[model samples]
Target: MDSSIPSISPWRLSVAPMMDWTDRHCRYFHRLLTQHTLLYTEMVTTGALRHGSVERHLRFNAEEHPVALQLGGSDAADLAFAAKLGEQWGYNEINLNCGCPSDRVQRGAFGACLMNEPPLVADGVKAMVDVVSVPVTVKHRIGIDQIESYDFVRDFVGTVKDAGCSVFIVHARNAWLQGLSPKENREIPPLRYELAYQLKKDFPSLTIAINGGITRNDQIAEHLNEVDGVMIGREAYYNPWLLTTWDAQFFNSAESSITREAVEEAMVTYMERAFKEDGCPWYAIARHMLGLYHGQRGGRLWRQVWSNHKLKPMQPREVMAVARVALAKGAEVPA
Candidate 1:
């Protein structure tokens, strides 16, 4: 471990920085599920901040506490400046996105491609650390393309660690930079949990969190023994109920998990308030929660009622009433 590395930050459970999905409203809804699980914003590129309005890219609710701002860029100066803006906007941590395999991100000269250039990443991390008081972190893939050696990721971590970044979120899969879409890269590459576990063994001083393909609570429990934390992506968004149980199960939290009905009602209230406050549409918030009823009997019909375009003219409370009536008629609950 490099002497310059900062102290490890506790990240027992977190959500991945999904591009279009994890926005401010999505995060506020997720916070209702489990208060303990850390949440991240979608990756904000340096160009968006350097040239555009910083507040538009960084605005977040205070309730989304322990939230992190993930930056996408290859330039050290731009990243550091963006990180400073994030801190000023009240983010808890600053994370660099080096694991994203998207073509747009690739063209920007950041994301997974940076894995092939460690020195540049080190300089960027150091610059961000120098400008902010918050902990600077990195989220990256296990390897890139045909590079299968474990040394590839190990060496990347070692180099970045020298720049005062001690916390790493490793998506345990190789990022196929070319000939693979971002969605394919997430699924095609086989997960090697051992590689992340070995990272902890080799760099005991740094905090390591394993991401990719981890969906269940049992899997989260299993990985906790090997690394400092676990990060969930699609599953947490698709089946958000999975997160309701996370706090009590993983954090030894006494906070009882809220019922699905309660969550729906809370969201309905939120939708009404958001409409009055910001004129936000009801469906925008409801769309993120379609999976709330997940495995129940009439969950599909319930979701359909909420998503119906004809109902868009109705208020969220009216939509909620219709959805409840549909669920009641269908007996959505399992016997």
Candidate 2:
């Protein structure tokens, strides 16, 4: 092991960063569930950092440590500066986004499109690596469009690795760059986990983490056997309780004793404090936690009370009380 490397792999288990999700509040909520699992910010474009408010984009709760900042851009200079900002703002790692196939990203000449230009991606990675001491990683698909040749992705990893990126978070699926909406791209692409495994085998010195269609803990365990880590995507957001078991199962820590109710209470306290300090509304925070009781009895009713627009004017504690009452009774919202 390198002297710089930690005793435990920081990439061991993580939540994949998703746009429109995985914001500061979401990361904070996840922190309450598992202390050790790595969290990532949604893809922050270099242009945004160059022209936008830095605080609004980089601000995060201190508890979200071991959290990574994922940047979406191809310009080496912009990436280097954005990565420096991320490190200065306390992000634990800097990740390059190479697997997103959205049209917007394409227009910006990055994301999954970057896969077509390995040298360019390498430049960006090396630029960031030179500026930040934190580990630089890349999250990308196995292939792009109809090109399924293993060599396409193989060469990509080889080139980027040379540029000082040692960790690769493989999405385990081809990114259909055309004709597929982002949602469709996520599901329609066939997952070939073997490609990710092969990347680990071919580059044994590198840390390879697998992602895509990995929802169950057993699946995470199975992948971990083949790779260095496992990253859960939308599943972690929709079924957050799944995170409650990660520490005990993956990190060999004690089992979590917190229950669904307790987590909700904690969120209520956080919501009040957030509003008091930042004027952020409870509903804004509440939206991220609506899935806290997912698959539990009366969960829909609980979500209903919390998501109800009429409750916007009420205090978060009051809303939590109403939600708990509705959850226990399993009845419709009061008129």
Candidate 3:
């Protein structure tokens, strides 16, 4: 919400919506490192929202503003209802997940399978858009299984666009749902960034973001020259400091020169507040911070000290004390 940061253009940098990885605790910690970049929530199933504790699933920190919620489902009514719940919970945007190829997702008749039924996705988008003022976006793969033609993606985008979606986050790889494990699906699929670039060329009016295997800042800058946005996944989570420096390197904001000591102090405060006020378990939030100092001096020692001691049912403040001692030793930490 900084006045100087551009608001109207599509996001130039975004964190991908990875299940079990982009939860509220993870987003809260990432926010400390970057203020301008957009963050996404783990994908939530529409069934979970309709029949489960919707409030608990949607809870997020106030600092994690400009966050988007990704929903997984194919039914228009369920998706629309879920989008309404997301709006009421104060999300900046609602994203439909059409790229996941897991078997569990396929059984629900959603995810990447929806790519084969573009009209159904369009109907779902239209229904969600009608009820929420926030933007309804879509994240999808370039192609599913062996359908490698550019025309396959182009037609999918074309159909969905007619339903009033202005933003499309395209994972540059084709998902081989039949043979690949979800983990292998992310790696084994060959990336076709050219298809995403072509999408930008064809639909100049729509926001086209390219995602898949992007990690380095230089690569992100190069991708930005051709696409509307760049979304980073596993790399962002494993080495989060990459995002902490984004506001300065990409957005040209003043560098956050805050040191490891300062970040630790901030986390201590956050941990206390979350445990006392939000009723979050100490370990639930602590798990996300383990990678915070991933490759820094003494980081592994610091992580080991916490990992070895903190889970023994100690207080959150006690864990911070152990981490501070390990960090003081200044040893090299393996990432």
User: Can you give the TM-score per candidate against the true fold?
Assistant: 0.95, 0.96, 0.94
lDDT per model vs. reference: 0.92, 0.94, 0.89
lDDT of 3 by residue, 1-335 (tens): 79996664547899999998899988988888889889999999999999999977899988998899999999999999999999999999999999999999999999999999999999999999999999999999999999999999999999999998999999999988899989999999999999999999999999999899998999998998998899999998888888878888888789888776676677778878887886777677777778778877888878886677435577767878877778767663443
RMSD of each: 3.7, 2.9, 2.5
- lDDT head-to-head 1 vs 3, winner: 1
lDDT of 1 at 223: 96
Candidate 2: list runs displaced more than 4 Å. 1-6, 331-335
Could you tell me how far off, in angstroms, the CA of residue 126 lies in candidate 2 after the best superposition? 0.8
Write down the lDDT that model 3 would get: 0.89
Error of 2 at 138 (Å): 0.5
Worst 10 residues of 3 by lDDT: 326-335
Per candidate, the number of residue pairs that clash is: 0, 0, 0
* Candidate 1 residue-wise lDDT, 208-316, digit = tens: 9999999898999999999999999999999998898887888867866589889899899988888898798989888889998888777888999999999999988
lDDT of 2 by residue, 1-71 (tens): 58895576889999999999999999999999998999999999999999999999999999899899999
When 2 and 3 are scored with lDDT, the better candidate is 2
Which residue pairs show backbone clashes in model 3?
Answer: none
